[model samples]
Target: MSPTHFISIPVASPGITENLRKFQDLCGEKIHPHKVQYPSKLHLTIGVLKLFSDEEVQQACNCLSEFSAKIPPILCEQPLHGTLKNLRVMRGDNQFVKVMYSEFILSDDSDRLQNLADKCLEFFVERGFMEYQYNTTAVKLHCTLINTRWNNAGPRTINASEILSDEFELQIFGNCVLDRIDLNEMRADKSFVAENDKRYLNVSCVSFK
Candidate 1:
């Protein structure tokens, strides 16, 4: 399986970078615990393919080339929500990102989101990867800024969603960079124990989308 392999997408936007800067100012010293420490570049995930042989990898890459030719990149804008209004930024089973981003401010465009995810999944399946499905409702397209341990730690003074008078402005929607895809290995020590050691491929970002 080529040791470990995956397909990944890159995500970085000016709006997002600005928001990260704001978060650093607002969050102060508490932001260092983040995996990236600070907000790194970001990207939307398209498909997840497993590792394969040289011929198989070439075949998969060919499939991706065809896919990119067919589907262009997508530019989108999503409203931002902080921990105050999102879900209190707690740490526990699948509760941090999903409970907040899923239910906060996104539109109920499950059908459309799922359709996109399914397209990615189908491509992987054709590449001989296993079939997996995530509900559009559960699909998180958000670029997170803070993820605090929800144990006995003290609460944050300000939440990302509540940065302004009422709501936080986390403008992440931008050009869909479909220029390339990357292969990343999944770490065994992820937040979710079950997802450890899982590997997949994803689309990086392109020049225009």
Candidate 2:
């Protein structure tokens, strides 16, 4: 069977998205323009489920709905504020990087966010939706700012760390409200290029007390 691709939630907010767009613009000027990610597609991945079947995906969605209801609305009292700071690269030993991303600093109530992620992983693993052996401890909640996978402009060696120096100013991109969990798919071409509206098979929205 083919491997199924999906991203676990905590999608970005408009404020964060706007900042991501600005960063993309900056990359276009400073780094390779082709490396930037689409503003609308920017998201913080919680986890990924590989080699899932269509039925398994549906089952996972159902589980998400149940899990979402249990997660209290995160940082909803006031808009959840987070800062986009620092640039890092995920590199393979082959001398090429897999992804480039920005580290986010959640203002407060971060424990709530981490707990939610832990619960999601626990649910999936317990139900066999995700592999039991998969180490959930390693999951870092982050957003991918640049990916080389879909870049048609070809490869280029650029040190993101060098381009983004400590002197570079960081800003609070935006406020986020964790109201929903989205279930998305990866296409055969290994890209989530489908219209964002159509790509989500299910969106589990939270109902806060």
Candidate 3:
């Protein structure tokens, strides 16, 4: 798959970003420096897509608008509030993990968040804009914190011993409040412009609030 774009909830809250930096500092000696995510690049992804042309990108933009318009007034008027309270391994395999992420604990109704994710995924997939491997019935919200892929050195997996220590077990990454969904560029381009220090190319964004 070309995998050009993805839908994501941007995380730029001041308290959250500051705490993320603190979390990274605590992890500095263990994980490779390249593997840590920049605070500006932090986000909770909804779905990935493969759009190959301008028309396709614009169509995806249209779909975002349509999806945003249909939301209920109660859910749409305010931000989707949540917290980053725990760290998790991808697929629960801590021995050989390519990704370590912070769990998103929604303070708002969990089912409402699930339904929103399901409906959003359904909207894009049914229209042939995106095909998500994320289960449509239950989508777990998470923001990736460490990725081994960025490390150019030998093995690209972090072992159990290399995982975060017990001190981080009850550690809170930060609180997240998101209202907008962006169809943004997944592949990084050096020539792209940055919006408020965000490096990704944003084709379109629709605010639920």
Candidate 4:
């Protein structure tokens, strides 16, 4: 496959972007953390559609358009720091200087958002599109962290005492609407670097609120 397409919500924040770039640079040059390259804009994936013919893509778009209209936009928060099993590294400042993945913070009253995701999956399934399966937790969210490797490293644990005792704020928020879906075709067989183009349907967003 050359490219692939999916429904996703991109995370854009200066704090995250700056640290992510630095982490990638360090991994690539000094630390030599095996194959830790920078990432494209981080995103929360809602769905993934297999490559389809042009006509099928058009149909998918129409369906997604209707789907978008039926749902109101969702707003959510970002994670500060959490523990995974084995990945991520901490630096001198006791900050999450290097991490493979970031968790999302969910609002307690997120039933509305969860309902929308459920309805979207039902809509796709009704249309013979069985590729829509959401996470089961009430959290009902996803995030773009680091790659799965770095088995030697475990969930990053920083020495909070060593660095600024005060908590560092590193969170971003955005309104996610079910905008247009893409019809990407993957050339590279690799899941990470599958080359593809995206024709993003109009997306509206609001920054930290």
lDDT of all the models against the reference?
0.40, 0.58, 0.74, 0.42
Top-scoring candidate (TM-score)? 3
Superposed model 3: Cα runs more than 4 Å off: 73-76, 134-137, 153-155, 160-165, 189-198
Off by over 4 Å in 4: 1-3, 23-39, 73-100, 106-113, 132-140, 148-209
Kindly report which residue stretches of model 1 are placed more than 4 angstroms away from their true locations once superposed: 1-5, 33-40, 72-114, 133-140, 144-209
Residue 54 of model 2 has an lDDT of: 64
> What are the RMSDs of all candidates, in order?
9.2, 4.4, 2.9, 9.4
Q: What tens digits encode model 4's per-residue C-alpha lDDT throughout 1-209?
A: 42245545454445554655554453343233333433334554555566457676666666666676555453233222221111223223434344333534333434544454566666665776435444442223455444324334543332323222233232232323322223233222243553222223322221222
TM-score comparison, 1 vs 2, better candidate: 2
In model 2, which regions exceed 4 Å deviation?
51-53, 73-81, 91-96, 132-138, 169-172, 188-209
Candidate 4, position 11, lDDT: 46
Q: Candidate 4 vs. truth: CA RMSD?
A: 9.4
Residue-by-residue lDDT tens digits, candidate 3, 1-45 = 668899887876777777877876766566775687777778878
| TM-score for each predicted model, relative to the true structure | 0.49, 0.73, 0.86, 0.50
lDDT of 2 by residue, 4-121 (tens): 6554555466777667667666655545655676555556666667644667766777777777656655434444455656677766432456577776566773666666666666
Model 3 residue pairs with clashes: none
Query: Which candidate comes out best when scored by lDDT?
Result: 3
Q: Of 3 and 4, which scores higher on lDDT? A: 3
